[model samples]
Target: MANPWHALEGVQVSDLGEKYFLFKFFKEVDIHRVIIGSPWTFKNHLLILHRIHENEDPLSIPLVLADWWVQIHYLPPGFIKESMALLFGNFIGKFLDYAMKNLSNGYKNFMHIQVQIDVRKPLKKKKKIMLSESNLRKI
Candidate 1:
């Protein structure tokens, strides 16, 4: 059986060095078939994917996926105030995993997902906060 995951080739990251990543999916035979996201697409897409899972909670759907990968870029301006890299990274990864499980067998939808973080300018001093498991208690 051929894998249905897509491969990304000739992919380019944004000039600003914004966090960018490539998600690849292959069929059982390992053939690349889709590439639908860029570093720029993460911000807009991340939240939507999150909600889908929240709304459908308690019921875990199994997505038949061949392979999935994410390339992350640094954060954008203003958004860099607080470092949520680790936090967001896991969030994004979880969402991608969920997405993989949700993709129906034989159904095609361009769902290459990415999460972008804002990186500060060079030679600049920024406040980096340490996020811990205890913080989740406050939420």
Candidate 2:
């Protein structure tokens, strides 16, 4: 089905009808799923897949950072910037979790997940780059 997330403002869905599909439920197009079949190629940059299920047969929608950036860059002037950061961070975290749990396996190359946080007070120095390794070390 056509990517539900792609339907979001400013995000583009490639290969529609040719590879992707748009399914209707209850005559509403908003509640459909985006299914990426196997043998997919994640060109340059990270190939992010948001896992929707845990069963052997699951649906993974392909996402890219560039596309996300485009969406964020084109956001309406009235929208708060923090909202974009939060969405991007959440997407990054979810994508990283999925990759570490699923795609990182059976691979020789090592992968890393990085998260940025601004924990200091408003008058603080700057934001912090909290690597995922630090959390794992603590555990």
Candidate 3:
């Protein structure tokens, strides 16, 4: 049977040499149907077969389970900077949550902790630093 999804332009799908797949798209497109439908069908088939062989050795059960994950990368015309900032904020939040849980004792007496983030535009020209005579001699 011919796969209809093969006709999609700017879309590339490749196996990751494991139980994972990498789907890349060059432009914005709706891929919700493919993502939601394919994994369920494959996993459901595994589940059905597992049930049929209920008497199989328990140690071999994990080998028959089907697991899949999808990671989407979408870069629009002007949203790259905004998306990167959002991702950075998410990472910081997760890191703080983990640190607070593990190092709770260090912050127990503090009323509040303030975090300041400075974001500035990069300079077009690089500035050279002048070295003192003594510093040059040490080098």
Candidate 4:
């Protein structure tokens, strides 16, 4: 995990037993960079991260939520508006933000949305929505 993170200085991972770990980073920037690159996994299991304060117990910190960037592809004609991203994002998970800046001007196949989801829950590959005009909205 540390190797893929590419921390500028270095990182130390402490095993806390029962699948929990305390990740210690030498550089503050490296830690922040790792956090910004959310939704990391190891051996197909989700690696949930929490920044605990000094003197806090690592095991006690909440670890139920994880942020993920979901790609919504081939949006229906009526569902392609920027404002609709919030609605679609919330439908998948807790809407965090719409990544409109990530999309190129020429790109039209999909949209990016950041959402916070429960790590315990299974992710859905496809979603269905209903539009007043179209009756069925699948993206």
Candidate 5:
């Protein structure tokens, strides 16, 4: 039988420590498909995909301001920042691994990784009015 993980053979993996690994691909990969297909394989990893810039330090890779970004929620009382960082690192690693293996055909449109946070404000409460009174006035 062929190895199921064979596709990922070319991906470069780095240990970021704290259970975080960095997976880097040599070519651009479709982030949308990666995200859509991630849950099946990366159930335990938080997968974050970002474009790798040439000559730029990975630590300073500016966040892409696009529609696809990770949302950070208030952690339950005991969750620490270190834990969150590890989770994010794991995601980045897994995403790179998946992209390298699955997106090898060619680069697709909108292939860059973009990040944006969606903020939804609660709707204001509306005051109740008497419909009958309004109807009577109209009559």
Candidate 6:
């Protein structure tokens, strides 16, 4: 685990008993890096990480959220901006980051953004967005 994380100051991983473990990082940047680079797997099983907050129950806190990069395809020409991608991402889940470099790919067919989502929840395959009552686009 520490090998893949590549923490600058190294990390201390402790077994918190049964399915749970604690990760101690020397820098906040390391923690941020790990959290952003989510949906990790070891031998095909998902590894969930949650930052233990002050006064929070380690065992009781739910660990269902994971950061995912979603590619929005077939977007209309007018909806390719960062703001629009953010709106669509927020509609799907909590928006994290947008692929700024991919803002205008060949033909402007897709937009990619990272969002934090609950793995336990079923994701929507398609959604209809109404910019106004007169304009509706299915994404």
Q: Pick the candidate with the highest lDDT.
A: 6
Scored by CA lDDT, what does every candidate get?
0.30, 0.32, 0.32, 0.80, 0.36, 0.81
User: Residue 107, candidate 6: how far off, in angstroms?
Assistant: 4.5
Residue 123, model 1, lDDT: 20
Evaluated against the true structure, the overall lDDT of model 1 is 0.30
Per-residue lDDT of 14-115 in model 6, one digit per residue for the tens?
887878888899999999999878878877988888889999878887788888888888776677788887888888888988884353445666778898
Worst 10 residues of 2 by lDDT: 93-102
The residue-by-residue lDDT of candidate 2 on 54-106, one tens digit each, is 46222344433221211223222232234435544454432212122123455
Worst 10 residues of 5 by lDDT: 93-102
Clashes (backbone N, CA, C under 3 Å), per candidate, total 23, 2, 0, 0, 3, 0
> Which residue segments of model 5 deviate by more than 4 Å?
1-9, 18-20, 27-43, 61-115, 118-139
Best by TM-score: 4
Candidate 5's error at 78, in angstroms?
A: 46
Scored against the true structure, residue 20 in model 6 reaches a CA lDDT of 85
Q: What TM-score do all the candidates reach, one by one?
A: 0.18, 0.17, 0.22, 0.80, 0.30, 0.76
Give me candidate 3's TM-score against the actual structure.
0.22
Give the Å shift of residue 72 in candidate 3. 32
Candidate 2 structure, TM-score to reference: 0.17
**Candidate 3 colliding pairs, count:** 0
Candidate 2 residue pairs that clash:
1-21, 2-21
Cα lDDT of model 3 by residue, 56-91, tens digit: 543343333222221213322232233333443333
Q: How would you encode candidate 4's per-residue C-alpha lDDT over 39-95 as one tens digit per residue?
A: 788998888999989899988877999998888887765566566788877787898
Tell me the TM-score of model 5: 0.30
- List runs of model 4 lying over 4 Å from the truth: 101-107, 132-139
